[model samples]
Target chain A: MATNIVWHEASVSKEDRREKNDHGSFCLWFTGLSGSGKSTLANALAKYLFEANVQTYVLDGDNVRHGLNKDLGFTDEDRKENIRRIGEVSKLFVDGGQIVVTAFISPFREDRQQVRDILNENEFFEIYVNCSLDECEKRDPKGLYKKARNNEIKHFTGIDSPYEAPVNPELVVNTESQSIQESVKTIVQFLEEKGLIKSGISNGI
Target chain B: MATNIVWHEASVSKEDRREKNDHGSFCLWFTGLSGSGKSTLANALAKYLFEANVQTYVLDGDNVRHGLNKDLGFTDEDRKENIRRIGEVSKLFVDGGQIVVTAFISPFREDRQQVRDILNENEFFEIYVNCSLDECEKRDPKGLYKKARNNEIKHFTGIDSPYEAPVNPELVVNTESQSIQESVKTIVQFLEEKGLIKSGISNGI
Candidate 1:
């Protein structure tokens, strides 16, 4: 190597990216029961944010469970570790100045709290996708509820296991009472009002 | 709640992001001994890419070890798990339509090959930052080499642990023979020739 060779002074900072992206960055953590429309809401909102020129990505079981957390099983310990890794990954996306929307059952309050502890006060906004168990079971989007009822899926959340609902979430969208677009619009308006995202593109709420 | 709203046809695809960012999305995986300038080169190239309006992010020990892989230790199993998680995260970035630059002393060929298998053929590019052990030890950028020599660090690559060099790397920059600028220029030109990054900005070699 040349004697004069030196390290660059800095890498691009999160603020630099936020400025370039023209929006603040944070995590929109959507937790809900199976068939509660968490993934649908998360993806819909991500698409809306992308259209509005906000750097956004969705982290859901479809992308995460089979990839990053494949080694983890459905055991209690594995579930906790799964949430921890996902939280850390979400933090990285936020660090890159992109809004990361994650959809996971995340049944435990402790697991959700751990993720919150890792981020700043305003960086993690938990949005509870509220739905009655009867409604979720009726929808059974993935047939998970049927499997759980059949004793095929042991310790399934909101069935064999318990779901500790968020006592004080940043927002709550009752999926049973509203359409997906309505849920997306409510969240977008909330984010815009909170100054988490810039007000430019009309979300057509 | 409105009843007419429906799921969008698609979220942003990798192709859409590639066209939007005007650059190819892939992982530039840098592997070498400690103090071999992997982080420096990765960040410098990332800075260049960002300046060219390419969506780019770098995953290094500074950002990852203390957070995503904080629970992992120096054990062989832990190291393998660490690399696995990093590879999976890189795949997510590529899926999101951004070039991800990763700097780690990933010492196992099998681990590196696993990451390659997870990604498409062109998505994973292994760049060996070749530097002589003598030169790296002399640099001692983080004093890690000194600690390893003093037996203060266990399983330190190129000292107590082995570093399996790439059998068929996409590129190898001899850091012992060139400056950082030259290395960055070499990589930028190589990427341009391969159409990994669009040819627009003239990188001054």
Candidate 2:
């Protein structure tokens, strides 16, 4: 009877997937306060990589919660669960040999560390989209800061909730000072330097 | 200083990988008692898929513990961690659009549920490799039954620990009477039915 169990397994090996993609895939975790341009940067990075024929996907805070993690809430436990699911999803992309760019407030260090531990050591790259509370508030493109000030939003990372900056992120982008084009250029250059993109892959014009 | 922080990003897209692979990928979670032919069936399944030009990988119990899951143990917490990591890895494969086959003595319903919860509902396929303890002992392919009988292997499932059979598995393969070839054919048929694989794909003959 032991011979009767039929299991449908993976069709491709991990190495083959990586090779077919023509570049190593890893998690690009972006952490910052809301309106710090994390999602903007992540989107642009994904577009640039895609144009260059790189396999890429973006997991922004808003997009993921809308679908894959819609059941979660804003409470501490829910936030942790939210990040946990994202970490698992990101790990999936990395394993498939695709670059994954995730942007979230991700205020807690322990949660970020949990994500790192889930993936391989070198596969996780934390990018702190560093912008001061004042700067982020000024650029409150979503008016989230105003809502939080009016008590319309509770546990806002930079307000009632705390935003613990990464002690040592892979890249620190000051979104307040850099132009969007410049920021994308910097990120694209970083990806090229990391050999995620081919050498001399031009940033969008 | 920046070089110290590695940026891990994939240079490929999910659609690109899927187009190249010519099939969508998913995770096949196989649960059963040791010596029940989970690994035997998983290996044969992977081999068959590989030959058929489907990208595949198998995370067998012994192989995973020896590498990806080395830090874990038999304790409940460790077991949770073990299943959790496997879930993460499996998700990675699915994202890369490659089918992943995992075989473990994942004894508890709760643990298996946790894994399923981590994965998408449609992406997770639970295959129960059903073999009676009496049959498993008779097979004793790894001499594990002998070890357990001698008290050399403590906390062994179906001996010291409980082995909760899946109540409603997606597929039940009775290893007692079916031949290995029959088992592989059944699994492949399931995949084809699910539209995961094209019919008549030469799975490595």
Candidate 3:
């Protein structure tokens, strides 16, 4: 079916969009166990970048599941498809000249690697949000651990299911030790040091 | 798996991004048969809007299928899923504060309505690229019509399958009769008249 289709090139390329936005575009993929503060950190970073006039967007698990991945379930295959779709969407956002941040548990190394393979060099950054399963269970911000313990929810990451930590991520932020503000600062500092954003932006104040 | 998930609200919302970009965000869905100039018109409009300093993006069939919808095929169910996924992605672009244009065959009214139902009023504007099958086949930019006629392709819209035109589209630009420049001007004028975009932008010249 795709053989007959021809690619119609866009007049406004990613480089042009980046030049207009005054910043580089890339995807920041945050993976970790539940309650590890991936969503919190991603949102905080989005706010900081927006305040600094850097074009950015965050794709968290909840918001994405409600729309693009609504039809998917919690099977291992579905989980892989979920992360794959998110990676593709993030690629589109990057092409549109925005720093796209995605937060998900993403419990498999192979799935994460598949996402990375779809992106260009330096276009995908794996951010490992590190927190122990014990800490995550203790937090239980959404009472998910309790349900998983009660056998009410199956395939729960860090509970019944496995979470394969990143082997060599671009950055590692331990939410158990660092505050949300500190985590956001570390990420922003990394982006600036990598020349993703302008060097002198007051660190988002 | 989703029970433990909590929605983290973004500090910078679509409204804030729109304000920063100095324009509103909406989707211009271009629907018609293959070779009907949907991609051409959508790209023209995107370039015009981009030159006018209006944040814009075009989501076309070939590019999207090569990435996000690559797993899908041309079956009826797959076609519905394809449009559904595109609709979801376009919603994301709209949420990111961009005037997103989508080009797809999208031959079913019910499927198109499903997409329209997902968006709020004034957020989705369907543009019907009206062109006769004869004209489109004669043009045959991708030689798809020839393949379809030779029975090499099955379930091809307007040949082996059906194409349900929009009953009441926001606008209909007949590519057979109108120049691409005229078609773009009509659509842009409609956008301005509907206050979807700011007027007095010099037609992006």
lDDT computed for candidate 2: 0.77
TM-score of 3: 0.94
Order the candidate numbers by TM-score, best to worst.
Answer: 1, 3, 2
What DockQ number belongs to candidate 2? Answer: 0.11
Q: Give the Cα error of residue B41 in candidate 3, in Å.
A: 1.2
Model 2 lDDT at residue B190: 83
Better of 2 and 3 by DockQ: 3
Interface DockQ per candidate? 0.34, 0.11, 0.27
lDDT (Cα, tens digit) per residue for candidate 3, span B137-205: 999999999999999999999999999999999999999999887888788779888887787553533
Model 3 lDDT, residue A66, Cα: 96
What pairs collide in candidate 3?
none
Q: Tens-digit lDDT track for model 2 on A105-142?
A: 89999999999988886689998898889988988999
Q: What is the lDDT of residue A43 in candidate 1?
A: 81
Clashes in each model (backbone N, CA, C under 3 Å)?
1, 26, 0
Chain A structural similarity (TM-score) per candidate?
0.94, 0.91, 0.93
What does the lDDT read for residue A16 in candidate 3? 88
Error of 3 at B13 (Å): 1.4
